[model samples]
Target: MDHLGSWRFLKVFLPAVFALHHFCHAETAPYYSFVQEATSAPLVSYYDYIIVGGGTAGCPLAATLSESANVLILERGGSPYLDPINKTDKENFFLPLLDPSPHSYAQAFVSEDGVYNHQARVLGGASVFNAGFYSHAETDFIKEAGLDGSLVNDSYLWVEKKVAFKSPVLQWQSAVRDGLLEAGVLPFNGFTYGHINGTKIGASIFDMDGHRHSAADLLEYADPMKIKIYLHATVPKIMLITEIGSRPRAEGVIFEDALGVRHTAFLTKDSESEIILSAGTIGSTQLLMLSGIGPAHQLEALGIQVVMNQPMVGQGMADNPLNGLFIPSPLPVEVSLVSLVGITQFGSYIEAGSGLNLAPSLVQWISKSLVTILNQTEAKVNSSSLLGARLKVGIIIEKVNGPISTGHLELQSTNPNDMPKVMFNYFQAPEDLRKCVQGMETLINVVNSKAFSKFRYPTISTQDLLNLVATLPLNLRPRHLNTATSLEQYCLDTVMTIWHYHGGCHVGKVVDQDFRVLGVDDLRVIDSSTFNFSPGTNPQATVMMLGRYMGIKIQQDRHS
Candidate 1:
């Protein structure tokens, strides 16, 4: 057989034998065999590509690229297994990973300044715990982030197909949606299953049967060999192989396993190879600073030798602003921040996969159907327009502006567990604050509409402002309210993080528009960090799209 023919034959033959052996020899102590597994074929001195972090973006990129090249995806987490957190059918994957669990491999990182940082030491990375809601920027958001709109949109559509996101198909409890609609917040987007005006959807996950799903669900069905997952691993540093090019080329990555054993994986041994950093905003920025690719002054403070003096490595931080509107609901419904789960009652999810548990209903129920609908009519509004960032399908506002220019992430120590210093400078911009105030007003108006007139909800007037004053911090209170008539008070009271963190390594602010770290070659970042601003809604879909686009680029470069 030719090389291609032989490879295809073994792909089928080996899996069948392995499956039989696993079932029949279930009790056999770790079966030893002379046949080398596919993954162990070679610790090649060089690889065509090395992608760090097998997450929302990483997995798709790694899997797609492996079609033609020897791709090495080094995840801090181990391979995917059937665990509650990683289960294909489970929608509550947002359960935190800080605790010990078979489904997740967790780790922590401290800032070099001994101040602040957070890290995930899992295989799927953030995807293992995210709500699985998928969303993209309005046209304006991309422009604000200084990205090419056409390129971003084209890239987005490509990944959306790969991930196969379906609208929620279940009958989510109507209390939230009904209440919002009564309040005049017409379902923000008819296309957005749950998106209401000023509200966001919960989960964008769809099941294998082409229904509402979760990250675990989609990932579980993906071909295993084509995308090998390495969980419970922590990437400590990136090894740089400086070449004669204008920028220093990244050679490989060094990571530590759960057992504390250290190993080195390379991108290209001798010939030039590309390194893609799919680590989240926080993880990627920290890794870059640690490897001497960040601000010269900050690296010097940590006493690290500088390789590339890119000052914007950890600047321009952005995150979706979240505000909760609680109306009295008499129903005994379980609150799930990550996803809706009521459709299982009718067995619609298990049977025909239609009902309250359907993906569209769940999302509509959570976000009240704001973003999904607006995006359809408000196509003229780009990413920067108020509607684009303020109104999206997910329960988050993807609004952002240039943050305090001085903010940066720096390493506190060389220890991998040390968390990096994080400075969000949230609400530092007057425009951002103004948007929040306006968005809050719009939200309250929708809640008071006739469609949601039931529930006897009190209109959020100046009189009710006193009741929420306590929610704001003591120091920030003065800025929030005085007469209580100003919507700013309500905005400050309910404002929170949608947990869609990005822009730490934003384009122009940190990495270039191509997502490459300035002065660094073969190292591209295609994670949340690459966004100069936050996505208008759930960033999972956008991040995945970025991965798809970057994966193609990696392949092109490798062949060249």
Candidate 2:
């Protein structure tokens, strides 16, 4: 095809290519009984698989397990389906993440390290609130986790067929893609769901119309008769039956409803029945400690009965450190989530999002967040000032490749609903800071690339524009700093999260290769909590895959 023909083809059909691959995949979500309120739940219940947290991993795991076993999902938050702020439209993408009300889809929290972050409180978990970029786990991560190679691919297909959509490379993303290639990120892999070291367009959880398809949608694979999902049901502790000479067995769980009434849900007497914690990184780790499976000292101090003396339950917590540069588009840039990602060999990944017409919801969030993003003493130019202003902007961002710097989690309160006191010592390790600098350098190179020339004004020089954005940082260093020290400082002062935090219930430390808790029986952790690092560019793909992969493995193990 000629260059014009190729361009026409790509713009029209690239997004549909991967989207249409799921046809061979059978069935939609069965009309499973969705219990919105926990009050209606019977005081007692039994299932072959008692999965906790109906978020990204839980939903897929439950669906897959229900193929043969009865499953029960106890979710802390209610459904996001009827939520006004959690709409599927592209513009509503940031709204679910920004709303801070107690009942909002996103739950607001500040780390003990003083970083502000949000966790998904809605049923679909982070997948509902995330930027929706989808990609596979790194080969190294898969092998290290002892995942079966072929099974991993199959699991990815199963999840992608249901949730992932092929995203088209629009104007801003196309520019970013070319800029990455110009900067020598070689062997441009055009579009893939697999993790590769190159500039590529990955699948998105958002569809052709930019409507999101979260992990909650993966429930379609469930056997309607075999799955019972309880929304607004908070699992506080894993109910255990201890014997003096035998390992503690997780027999059931104690949970609370929205009305504060507590109930017990049990696993069957079947020897292979299990309690799976897919409550995400924070939720799983915190729940483990709350259930008396953490360090003996911490539990003793908190006045909790100890189930197992496991010291690594909440250790090695980390979040991918992120920083960005805001560039003004010469023309109005269409709003887009991540469509292009530049996976560099250096320990960083570059990606971008663009929008000119932002909704009013962004003003409050921007006012608070930009204060820290700009590293200012206060909001010099709050979002309040831009109430009706029509400004065009594109943001270029990079995540420092990691499980680099690590921290630990300790309980703040015994209440299961309270946020845990965890610290992700961002850039604390010298290597992490070095990677951050390398990423920032790569970002600068992209901005100055000839492919990005159209976004800048003809009058202003590239160096001048960078100096202006660089001035957003405090400490008034040289206006145009080319030194590594300035870049390192910028990373330190403005470090935020891509929300790809992992660890806590790390495999090999807290759990065995099969995801079973090291010191307990009939209990396993099957979420991002089991990861040593966040997988690939985004973790949702790997997380959902893990759920399905493990469900199949567990079924196989039961048969064997």
Candidate 3:
């Protein structure tokens, strides 16, 4: 019992006990493995399709294209298995992947304002942590972007079939859907999809055991297969290998893995594949600019070699300015905030192997869209003939006039560790501010409905919050909350970006209608970054649909 004897005994016993406890905890925890990337010579190979950034779009595109020939998805983010962020379940996964310490990509694209941004370095890209809402582009919105209405129709069919897009049938409370319908907010329309036209269209989400699903779910084509998903992979530039021809072809791409190791791949004659850039609006456009396929003046100023003088890159970038109305309800909202309210139902879809929870109720409040068109005004101008043309079935409203975003992404330094300088000039246009004011008014109207009022367990009086915003000083504008009393206050406080940047590389900029970069022959930009207009809804479903549609189209083009 002496001091020395007791201390020696305690040390020995404590060490043994601590070791046992550690082992026990490790064994009890759910076990998953992380694939260590190759540190030696690159594990490079040739394939018919090399889709960079295996994310929201590239993942599905790779899976769909793989059915035809070998497809190599080149992602800068290393393997998804190694990423802890990727292991997240449907709920509470929004804990960002911005920290570079554990995640794959070095520097995330965060706005200086912090209010408007997204974390995009992981395997599933933004889809991994995004609120699962599947919406189609409004027909009119699509048409304004210069695509025919048929494209949207075809895309909707293809996406629903491939991804098994469904709703919450068994687990969800039916009142959630019923309440919205009874509110008169959801006007019935024959077509269901975007907020513009599909008034009766339902929202979509993955059936993650009554949880939620992601691109990871649909991208997994084979079980227990090492499909080579790279995370933290950053494609800095698209390598344009000039083949002896009239025009230079985009032969391959240059990318760096999470380890900061750079590598290049050449498009071979045998596997004369396509290089798809689904790296997102910011990522894809940055890559194109770095590759010298963007605005000639911008490229020249930056001292970048001009491969193609496409002034449209980063030109028509647009995103929806989201404004939410949080009203207290008398009842606890039974609906899961984790999954979107899928309400749309088609005949025989349930019997045709699609689940009953196959539609979402989110699309119920959208306007009816009849004709969707995309007339690229920048590179190819449309005269008075295209203007003032009205279509059948639905009316189109310009909630946000398609003002080209003034945002741009450029390298901070040669070091990949240094995050890119991202500037989103939100509310740069007076029309955008006007749109935000109008959108907020709409949100207030919808959330203030009697049906929505009853969803809260304890009724919340939003008048005080609204009054507070109205009275707050200009310097005291809220960073966390975006509530405002008057239109001026709302415009001043809630004037932030949706973190959904698109159309930077519209038809004239980096890529054309087929999503192909003009100067680069084989390279295509498939991510939302290539959108000509922000598809008047959540951009994920549209991005995924485009991936699937483009994958099939490219495969067919090759075969033909």
Candidate 4:
């Protein structure tokens, strides 16, 4: 077998051995009670805390809360630990991105503008589905968000010990790193998680053996007897009671099991007992709207009684925009995900990843779809022809620290099963588009640098690509522009989301600094939805930090 084939075979074969080793020497493991078909069991009336969403934030938060208080976690999907295909097979890690099954670990969704994306439905949340790139937020982000600086610094360790690891920088990643420095993305900070303004090697969730440790692993901190997790418990709405002329208070949640049986879980009378919605940006916002806590007009139009007239519940959504340059190389690079990142002076982040040869049919479909979406052309050549003697390494340029061109989400219907209409007005701001162009320019420079010249094969240059894009017919341009006005037009056509969706239910608008929903008692949102702005990097580490930070806060409040 060739190098790539040998690597793929080893990845597939080694995991089964690891799985067996893990299963055989199991000691007296903690009794982490879980209800697969929650409907079959008698529903508990109340708990000290009901965390709706056993995901990145929810998993850690529930585990932490269970240390002192009775905690119940409702997950919309199954445990990743139980799935060998998703959890063990590293070669097929990205397969879930294409999975369309309702029970798939990654749930696929399409935006109003035809962009496809997926969100995690399993225990680790997106941490279980993403490419495992991990980085902390910039210090400015911490100050801007008004987070406790010291606590935030210390919080990372709590999560890092459980899942984070320094990625092994390989040949391709090293070349990319050197190229970034050569391109003037200076101050090469060595391996670290701090999000600084320069090139640096960040951590990842994937271990040395290519196995992923998710937020689910943090359940080791949980007092098993105090925590109960229910898989396939789809929460339809947060049950609330609004007294006449008084503020609404969250009572419990009404959910359904995989078997379609309904159940309700409420909070204890201890007033301190709260309902924390860590159901992610879309899920939490949709739940808020479905529970009649969104815009008054939207709720009344849907014939749902208004619980609160919070206009910001689903407003101000922001997703980091990304564009890329594919560089085909004659040599096979080590297979890896985001490791070396270039943080440019112009507020852009550049990163690269190596690829493996997938099945021909799958490759054909993907290539054809990408060609159609990106170039708006017919697939005249067979997919096999596209793959020449050399493989391609993707150089991704992201507008991380850019103008926040926020969008909004609207309810499609009163049905909880329906996905909210997401319109992430990416690059809506001229400054945002300008930043993206700068990012692409930096990436182009990096690829042209001497560090990459040895391995890089001759291909289209940046100027040639731009000029060709400029020559495209006006109507054929993105958003029906009359002309290719500038490189921004090309950006509009090529820019896509990097899956780092944030805002919507933002601080100072939908929720308070403590993450509690305004005008509502005994309720809180503790996910990316609470972020006032994107952290300008892969958000998993920050999300995990937020989980730890909030867990400590909640514990302190309960004790006080």
TM-score versus the correct structure, for each prediction: 0.68, 0.87, 0.70, 0.88
Q: Which model scores highest in lDDT? A: 2
Q: For residues 87-116, could you state the per-residue lDDT of candidate 1 as single tens digits?
A: 433333323433435434444332222222
Q: Which candidate, 2 or 3, would have the higher TM-score against the true structure?
A: 2
Badly placed stretches (over 4 Å) of model 1 are 1-45, 78-80, 85-94, 97-120, 141-165, 169-189, 192-203, 206-228, 243-247, 269-272, 334-407, 455-490
Residue lDDT tens for model 3, 385-439: 2222110011101134344445656554434345556655656767666665664
Each prediction's whole-model lDDT (CA): 0.51, 0.80, 0.52, 0.76
Determine which window of 10 residues in candidate 4 has minimal summed lDDT. Answer: 468-477
Number of backbone collisions per candidate: 78, 1, 51, 0
- Alpha-carbon error at 81 in model 4, in Å? 1.6
Worst 10 residues of 3 by lDDT: 346-355
- Those runs of model 4 whose alpha carbons end farther than 4 Å from true positions after fitting are 1-31, 85-90, 357-362, 365-392, 459-486
Better of 2 and 4 by lDDT: 2
Candidate 2 C-alpha error for residue 223, in Å = 0.6
Task: Give the range where candidate 1 is weakest over 10 consecutive residues by summed lDDT.
Answer: 345-354
